[model samples]
Every structure is written in C-alpha cells, then in structure tokens.
Target: MPQRKIAIIGAGPGGLAAAMMLSAKGFQVQIFEKQDYVGGRTSSFTKQGYTFDLGPTFFSMPFILEEIFESSNRRLEDYVTLKKLDPMYTLSFDDLTIKASSDPEKMRQNIEKHFPGYGKNYDRFMNDTRKKMNALLPVLQNKHASLFDYLRLRSLKAIPQLEIGKSLHDVLSKYFDDERLKLSFTFQSKYLGMSPWDCPGAFSILSFMEHEYGVFHPAGGLNQLAKAMAEVVREHGGEIHTGTGVKKFILNGTRDISGLELDNGETIDVDDVVMNADFAQGMSQLVDDEKRRKYKNIKLQKKKYSCSTFMIYAGVNKPVDLDHHTILFSEDYKRNVEEITKSKIMSDDPSVYVQNASITDPSLAPEGKSSLYILAPVPNNFSGIDWHKEKTDFRDLVLDQVEKRAGLTDIRKNMEVEEILTPYEWEFDKHVYKGATFNLAHNLGQMMYFRPHNKLREMNRLWLVGGGTHPGSGLPTIFESAKITADLIARTYGVKEEKA
Candidate 1:
C-alpha cells in the first residue's frame, strides 16, 4: 500500500513533532513552514555572534517530550542534554523579593518565611498539584475530549474536588490569605493568557505543575531544544519545507479535505492535514467565506488572549546580575491586566519581566556583553490604539521600571543592538490572534471541552495542533499536543506504531 501522505502546515514544535511521530510510524509526512526556519513563533535568531530566542524561553514536562523520541526508539538525551535550573526564578516586586526554587523543602521554607502558615499549605498544594498533574499527564499524550476524558478518571475522584467552576483568584484566596502569596500562586495562570480573576477553576492545574515540575531553561537557550527537536525529525526520515506558504485547504463538496494548495497555485493530495496556524486567523482568512460565519455566530467569549507584550531585545556591554528568569510585576497587578483586556493601550506603570539569558547561558552573547530580553504585557490593539505613537511611550515606561527594579542607572548608551518586538509586529509578522502569545485565555468556559478541538467543525481529515488548539499553549503542551494528534491519526488509520 502507498504510504499515507500527511501534510502538516507550520513547522512549529507541534507540527514538527506530529510530523516526526507520524513519519516514524511509516506515514509519509511533509511539513511546510512559511518562515525560512522552523519553530514558528517559538523560534530564535542569531546575529553578530549573539543568539536570542524569538519566543517561548522555557520548557517543562520533560517526560512527555521524551516519550515522543522514544516512540521512534530514540532518546532525548541522545539528541540534547537537560539542565535543571537550581533557582527557577527571582520574583521582583516593588515591596518584595522571592526566590522560587526547584527544591520542594526550600520552596516551602521560602514561602513560610515570607508568610505565616504558608509552609504546610504550600507543601499540601504541591502534593495536590502533583496528583492533578499525574492524573492529567496520562491523557496528555492522547487525543482530547470533554466530560468523556474526565469520566475516564472516575477513580481519581478529584474532578469535582478540583473545582471546575471557580476563578483562579477565588481558589487561591481560599488557600492562602497573603496578598503576595496569592499573587505568587495565581501568577501561573499567566501561562494560560488570562487574568487570575477570569481563568477557569481547573487551571489550578498550572499551580501544581509550577511547584512540582518547577521552571527550567535549556543550557543553550530555549532554541537549543528546538534545534534538537528538528534534528530528531531529520533523523526519522521526515522532510521539512521552510519559506513556503499554504494557499488554502482544498476540499470536496461534502467538506472532506482533499488536498492543499500552495501560494504558487500547486495542489497535492494528502491523507491527512494538521494546521499549526493561528486558529482564529486560519478560519477567518483561509476557510471558505460562507463557512467562516459558523465560527462568527457561535457566541464564544473569544478566548481573552494573553496580554500582548512589548519586548526590548537588547545587547548590552555589561551584564546585569538577575537570574535566568525574573518577573517584575506592577504594584497594581489587577490594573495592568485591565489595561490589556479593557483599555487596550500601554499602561503608565507597566509590569515588566526581564530575562538575562546571558547569565544563564553565556553562549547567548558575545564575550564582553550580555543579551537582555525585557517584556511587559500590555493591551492588545482592542481599544483603537496606535502602536507607532505608543511604541516610544511604552519604551520609556518600561525603561523606568528596569532602572528602578534592576538598579541599573543608564542603559541606552551601552546597548550594542536593540530590536523591539511589539504586538503590532506579532499580528503582522506571525499572525498571532490579537498578538497574544498564549493564544486563547484558559477561562472557565474556554477550558477543557470548551477549548477548540483537534478537529474543526464540518471539516474532516483536517486537524489543528498548536496554542490555539485544545490542551492549550506553552512549549510542553504544544509538543504534547503533537503527540496526541499523531495518536489520534494513528488510531483512526489503525497504526499502533510500535517501537521500531
């Protein structure tokens, strides 16, 4: 029999991963990425003896990723080395400094030292998060469903106990009474791209993963992981095509995906298709217009996209002594998110997240200098804002925060190369919906069965695997999404793909 031809659009971690897994299963897979390189939005850039991760600078859930490699009878260590960060991050706020550690006892001790009754509560929360994670991890590498998947977990019985109806803020308030502790606890929902007040109750899972899994970065920077992943794909006899545009999904009258057309007006039939493109943009721009109205009339509260960031990627002559990761939140945390969701413009006193990648991996910058990526989530372009005029204002505001928080007096003159990545760029360049990094917010109604499915409605042999798809965003989640999609395809085609 002719090998099943699978066409995956976008060579992101998800698409590349799906291609790698399926190609190993003896399915013919071709990955097309519009950009000249892979990693979609999560890719990197190298210039003048310095390297910078263009997006997503962290990785967690190593086992799930290793499972993908093991499927092809390969080892992740064989392709790349895993480094555990001793101090996950330093949380810097105007009134507080917190050391988030990978060590459980140290983490709990730190929390206890900062807030009374925090020690035991933190430990209990960690254990709970682990249980929730363990319950969820098995389903991570498989296809998704709504109540059915949770029903499969009738024994864990923590489903209702886990609270699927409350907001993250409501849950955190019930657990810890301290404001900073509450902020620390609820910050994990930032990964879901929603305000703690608006995120789903089950997103409490992030709290579990954060404390249990801890935060980490690859030694060679986040892109190092992507390079390793691509290497694995190439080793498995899969082919990747970059600098290619997919014109449209070619379909028959009944909505079966027959093939895909490229920007050059060429068509190739395929057995299956996976789209890693922005879900909203994909359906809006690529689908048949008449079919587009279906998603429009649905009345979904449009996933409250994560705050779009205004990032300053600068190379400086002197390295600041910050951790590999650090978050400098605004004094008024709730107000910052308000500007993002409601105001839709740059905030006056913005919350900044600064990463001195050069400190973690010296290889990221030149010998005498360091690379700094400073980010602050601002409103997406919702309230009729203009980026051209606001860019300078946002730049100055963030600089003021950096100067005060990092204790760095002067930076503009010492900078070697400065590149700004704003929400406008994200919308135009990467086509991110509302320029939001995590795709859709993991709100209560938008979580679980509420998130977009692997299969599009009224579309067959068509699938989606990315931040916009179910199982949500982040490197590990998207990578796991690829595995789940591959398994779904395997089951549908009856190919178990045993270790070869």
Candidate 2:
C-alpha cells in the first residue's frame, strides 16, 4: 500500500506529536518549521556555554508525554532523562514562603506551617479535584467536532464535574480563608495566560496535577521533549524540515486546501495539512480573509487573549543558592494580574517565575556557573507598550524584583550573557498573534465547541493542533489536541491496522 502524505506546519510539540503518530501509522509525514530549530516556543538556545529553554520551564503530566511515546512504540526514558522534583516548586508571597510538594502529607504539613489549621482544606481540595480530573482528562483526549460531538458520552459524564460558572479564584476561596493561600493555587491560572479571577473553575486541576503527579525536569531542558519527538519522527521515516516555513496554503477551489507554498516559493502537495502555528497568526496570514468568518483577523483581534510575557535568559558568572523553580508574587498580585489582563499595561510590580535549572542539572552551565531563565507576565501586543524602548527598563525592573524578592543579590553584575524576548518580538518574529504566548484566552465563550475546532470548520483536508484548539493550552492539552486530530484523520481515511 502507498503511504499517504501529510504536511505539518510548525515543529512545535503539537506538530511533532502529530508527525510521530502519523508516521507510526505508516504515513509519509513532513513537518515545516520557521525557526532554525525545532520546538517553536519550547526550543532552547545557548550562550557562553549556558543553555536556556525558550518557554515552558515546568514539565508536568509526564503520563501524557509517556502515552505519546508508547503509542509510537518508543520509550520516553530512552529519549529524555526526567527527574521528579520533590518540593516541586517554591511559591513566595509578600509575607510567607510555601514549599509546594507532590507528596500530599508533606504538602499538608507545609500548609499547616504557613496557614495553620488549613491542612484539612488542602486534603479536601485534593479529594475534590481528583474526581474532577478523572472525569475531565479522558474527555480532553477527544475532539469536539460539533455541538453534538461535545455532548458525547465521555463529555456528558464530565458535565457534573465541570464546576461551571465559577472562576478558579472563586473555587479556591471556598477552601482557603487567606487570599495568599488562594493565590498559591490560583497563580497556576497564569499558566493559561488568564487571570485567576477570569480563568474557569474547572482548570483548578492544573494545580492538582502538579501536587498529585509531581513536576519534572529533563536532564538538558524542557526543550529536550521536542528534540526527542523529532528523533522519533525521523526514526519512523518522517521528515522534519527546520529553517523552512510555509508561505501559504494553496486552495483547490474554495474551501479545500490542496498543498502548501513554502516561503522559498517551493510548492509541495499533501493529502492533508495540519496547522500547529498560533491559530490567530496562522489564520490571518495563511487563509484568505473573505473565507474566514469565525476567526477573521478583525474578529480574532477582538477575542479575549492570554497575557504575553517578558522573558530574560541570562547566564550568570556564578551560581546562586535557589530552588529549582521559584515563583515570586508581587506585593499587590491581584493588581499586577489586572494590569496585565484588563489594563493591558506594564506593571510597576510584576509577578515573576525564575528557573535555576543549573541547580537541578549540572550540564546546563560550566563549572560553578548557572543560567537563570526569568519570565514576567506582561500585557500582550494589544497594549501598544513600545517594548523596543521599554525592554531595557523592564529588564532592570525584573532584575530589581529578583534581587529583592528571590535573594539573587548579584544577578545584575554577574551577567555573562543576556537575551530578552518581549511581546513585540513574539508577534513580529515568532509568528505569535498579538504576542500572546499562551494563545487565546480560556473563557467560556472561547472554550470547548466554541474554540477553534480540531478539524478546520471552513476548510476540508486541513486540521488544527496546539494550544489554540480544543481542550486548551499547556503541554498536556496541546499533546491531547494532536492525538485528537491524529485520531480524526486516521478515522476519516479509514486507515486500519492489519490483524496479526
């Protein structure tokens, strides 16, 4: 039998997942990535012998990644070395520090120390969310092609656990009396780029997943996941063309996409095309404006989006005593979140997440040197913040906050190399829409069947994957999106395995 050809746009985790799956199913898979390297936002770069992950420092939900590799007859352990973090992360509030642990008993003890008499509430939270996650995780693995599809058996069963009409902050408030304690769980909403007050109650499972399954760190970096998937694709006879980008999709007639025209002006035919690029960015440039009704450029511009980030990757001359991961909350965290989400302005006090991977893995830096990957949540490109001018000042602000809050006293003077990625760069250079790194917001209006379909609604033979699609963002959901799409494509083509 002849192999069917699939062309995937972007070599991010979503694209790489689909490539490996389809290739394993005996299809001719080819992935085109704009960047010189694979992994899109998940890729990494080195400076002064120090390596840094471009995005996504936290590696949670290891089972999702494991499932993908297992389905392709590959073992994840063979490709990437994952070390489970015991005190998964440290959350620093203005008045207290929380040593977040995956072990429930340890976490309960920590809760007792910080918020006395609150350990029982932590137990209650775990019990409640475990049930919700059990019902929700499987439903997320399927594609919601239509309203009817969303009402399927699995989703129907999950409806009761959905915790609709409440925000994450609202849900956590029921358990914790202290606002800072609530912030510990609610700050996870930032992972989706949504304000905790705006992020849905159902997403409280994000914090549960971390405390339940534990967070992980790859030996090199989180970016290693992409390289590992790319390796699997090649092993399965799939081709990955990095440093190559698709200029546009060629239409057969009106709604049928036949092939892709490369940026280099080379045209290639495909049986199907999977888009892993940012939905708004890809749709605006790749599809004709006239044909796009739901995700038209004007409409997309108006949609609620996740806040962008200001990133600083610095290789310090000396090592610092810090946890593997640390989140330093602003003095006025709620106001800071509001500044990013509602005000759409840079904040005077920004909540920052810093990863000292060198402390966890010795390979990321040279002897006695460490690399610091710092991310500060900021307004998306819609804010008109003039990052070109503000980049230096923002960097200084981030450094000041780090030194004051995180106790990294000498971060400023010891920089061997420094790289900054602002929202402007994310949009203009990285092909992200509005420079919203977390993609579209996870509001009720933009979720489930309302979100961009796994199967392109207007165009046949075209599919969508990644954070922008159904099930929503984060590494696990993005992987689930690819699985859902791969399953749909396989079913559509009536592809079947031969019985032994």
lDDT values, one for every candidate? 0.76, 0.91
Worst 10 residues of 2 by lDDT: 491-500
Tens digit of per-residue lDDT, candidate 2, span 61-143: 98988888887889899999999997899999888899999998899999999789999999999999999999998878887
User: Which residue runs does candidate 1 get wrong by more than 4 Å?
Assistant: 138-142, 145-150, 153-158, 296-303
Per-candidate clash tally? 0, 0
Residue-level lDDT of model 1, residues 142-167, one tens digit each, is 55555676667542464554566687
Clashes of 1: 0
All candidates' TM-scores? 0.94, 0.98
Q: Which regions of candidate 2 are displaced past 4 Å?
A: 497-500
| Candidate with best lDDT | 2
Specify the highest-TM-score model's number.
Answer: 2
